[model samples]
Target chain A: MYRALKTKPWISLLAFAAPALVFYVIFLLIPTLGGVYYSFTDWNGLFRSYHFVGFSNYVEAFTEDSRFIYSLFYTLKYVLAIVILQNVIGLGLAVLVESRMRTKALFRTLFFMPNMFSVYISTLMWTFIFSTAFPQLAEKTLLHFLDQPWLGSSSMAFVSILLVSVWQGAGYLMVIYIAALQGVPRDLQEAATIDGATPFRKFLHITLPMIMPAITICAFLTLNGSFKIFEVVYALTGGGPGYSTEVIAFNIYQEGFARDMRYGYATAKAMILFLIILVITVTQVAVLKKKEVEA
Target chain B: MRKRSLIPSSLIVLLLIIVTIFFMFPIVLAVVNSLKSQGEMFKSVIAWPKALQWENYKYVLTEVHILRSLYNTFIITILSIVGIIFCGALAGYKLSRTPGKVSAFIFFLFLSSMLIPFYSIMFSLIQVASGLHIQGSVYRLPLIYIGLGVNFAIFLYHGFVKSIPRELEESAQMDGCGQLKTFTRIIFPLLLPITMTIVILDILWVWNDFMLPLIMITDYKSYTLVLLASTFFSEYSTEWSYILSILVLTSLPVILVYLVFQKYIVQGIADGAIKG
Candidate 1:
């Protein structure tokens, strides 16, 4: 057997890859395939038997389930808000920090510090701020607007979620943008300046295009991340005020584990989510890659 | 023109200062109020405490067994990282060097799964875990992490291995070293840069991940730091002082690690983003 394996290089390759492959197959690959198969059945997670249900799960989720449909739109809104706001603020901070002569490192560290905390922990801290600090501040200071129900109303809850997400996320994109900004050729900026170009013009025409790849990367990161947001909403509002802030992942978690144990139905919803993410991300990457090449 | 430019530049600095304060607000507030008694905190969340409340930290530390949770997190993180590095490095090295459809297909198999979101597989994954009797076991959780993490690690290692010269391995082979020995002695040491990248990134994920531990680990003894802090928060939801202290204690280690390895962490994020 050893001699035969020695003669065949592919067998040795399998040997080398076998350890990782074993774990990956058992834990990840099997789960993924099992998820897809279970999506076509009516397995409620407890029974030893289940029957195939074809596309009923998909049709029901689309045509019948209002909560699931609402979550889909809500998640899309979240994705758009996070992608745009995170990149803009991140790039803005990067440009501003880079302009600092001596305090650049200090600012970078301070900005990225919040991201060091777990999302759960960050949400806890913000909960204190919203529940305790804001009301007290409103009483003490003249800033009456700070007294509003930041996490109570539907609109405010949406805003509050976006606020925390951006606060934790923007700094990461800033690091990427800072790197991209540093990679911008100093000579080109000098040339533009010498030609009497305003700083804004120099940034718009020169810096922006030079950092387009970083923009694409940051956008991709935020888009993928925001679509699957679970912990913040889970901990913060608990999808409060009648599920107004329910993201897709949270809705699926509710279906599969928390509320109903319809593992099959939840798996179907999960597949839909996977397809949406796959399609949107692939399209974004293809379009961004084209732009990156042109730039 | 110089005078006019100075105005906007200074204005930018002023704006930055305000934003920095805003960014630091939650952390500063948490830290400040963590030291106040609940009554003192209620008086004014922003005001200085009249008396220090070290008891909040003491209560969480002793009663809640937060230190044990921290140790549990450390053990799981280190073990999973070692497993990932070992498995990922071997498979990535062999697959990169070997030329064939089989190797390409195996590599593709690993790479394609990176697109599958964790939520997509998590439900069925729980079923698999329970079937294997690994659910709720702290020591066995790293195995699942290794499975989930190795794909990305393999991708990184595959890209990094290309830069290593093949002659190093060939020369080791000629010296009568077996393939495994050659890999361990020659190729493994050279993969340190990418290995560091993987270790840093995985440490953050495993240490901070809340959902997996929440679902898998039913026993409080197996609770990770984040999980314990979360449970503590929900139970003592109204006790701002105790909850704030727990939050601070939980975050202190990560903040310290980030401060000590600031440059490497930043570099790791950039490298992972660019390469990945």
Candidate 2:
């Protein structure tokens, strides 16, 4: 028995993985596939009777209903702006803190403090800030951009969510980037500095390339996270100003849970979102992973 | 050059100060606003409160019954954290020790689970949970939580455990220690750093979790602090003072946690983000 145990290492591995595998198959993989299957038919939550309507559900989504496609486009815009801005701000903060400043730890705490709070709570607080705090403060000082209705319009609403998301997300990513920045060899930096290379030139060359791996991970996280964003949007705007802020995830949620619970349609919409995310992730990983290695 | 430095340096410092206030002003606003009566809060107190209101905190504990919700959240968070650590450590140990085709296959499945968006599986999960008669109970929540989070926890553990030298286990084996004894006595203590990482990660996520609980638990009896605060926000959005107050109190626990364990939490994020 001892000899057999020594030889069959895979048996123990298989046993260790059994619980996770069972959970995934039952909860994740099966449900997702079932969701796709349900999309083909209009099966309400309560009914055993089901009629297979073929591709009409998808057909309606693409042709008859413009809302899904429009939301997809809006969500894409929101994501692109957010992912790029969040990364830029986060990288900047990392660069700032990596300079060995005296207050780096204090600044890091202040920056990361937003991330510790839940989004729903933050949004509510911001409602007060935008409406009351900023405007009140502006009355007494030159920094009075607070009187504007930050969440009252579609375009500004978009900017409002983008700002909050970045504020919350950047600190977390800054920690990662600072770690990556530390891993950059001080010897090389010294060599460049001694050779009369300006700080800008050195950063543009050494820092950027060395940090590419961390950038890739941050991009992946921000991309997937932005795509899945619902709570912040829901809390901040309620997908309001005439549904201009409705992302697909929130749309599916509103479809399913609100009103009469059109679960079948919501599942179909969710599957569409699933495919969008899957395609985006696979493409980014395949293409960017190579670029990262090259850089 | 010295003359040129002073202006830009001051300007940069000024910019940073402005941005920091921009980042944290809402939290300050909420804290100040929560302390005032409805009329006073509506009038917008941007500075420190004239007098701190103990009643707001009392309101949350009593009227909101946030205490009970806190108890429920505590039960779920503790159980789920314990579950993840135990299962993740056990599985991680086995995966590190055993290498072969089946383990790789299982590992791949776990990896894929992380990518599959929650919205995709959530509908069917609800259906399945409803069918299984596990809805509204704490027992059901942990399984779903484990399904979603255990992969990341296991992944962290797997990486950390691989660095543990095999020699210690061999000596234990020489002392006639069984595999379980070697794992528990020799191996478990060394896992403190990784265990802390896993615990902090799970706590942050499980504490802040709203989406999962929103769908799974329908009863107000099982609602978490975040969820209850969210409900309060929606219902009393017009009551800016009340909304602001709840928002402040809602953020207190997480803010406190972050302040306390921020070193480990930041390090955990750095490791997870940069390494993988």
User: DockQ scores for all the models shown?
Assistant: 0.59, 0.52
Where does model 2 exceed 4 Å of error?
A1-8, A46-48, A135-144, B1-12
* Candidate achieving the largest TM-score: 1
| Residue-wise C-alpha lDDT for candidate 2, range A124-235, written one tens digit per residue | 6776666666667777657666567677888888888887788778888888888888898978887887787777888888888988888888889988888999888888
Question: Best by lDDT, which number?
Answer: 1
Candidate 2 residue-wise lDDT, B1-276, digit = tens: 111111245655765787788787777667777787766665547555667776776665666867777787777888888877777777877776666776666666666667777877777889888887767777567777776778887788778888899999888877777666677899889988888878877887888888988888888888888888888877776777677666766677778878888998998878766545
Report, for candidate 1, the interface RMSD. 3.3
Clashes of 1: 0
Q: What is the TM-score of each candidate against the true structure?
A: 0.96, 0.93
lDDT of model 2 at position A22: 65
Give the DockQ-based CAPRI class for model 2.
medium
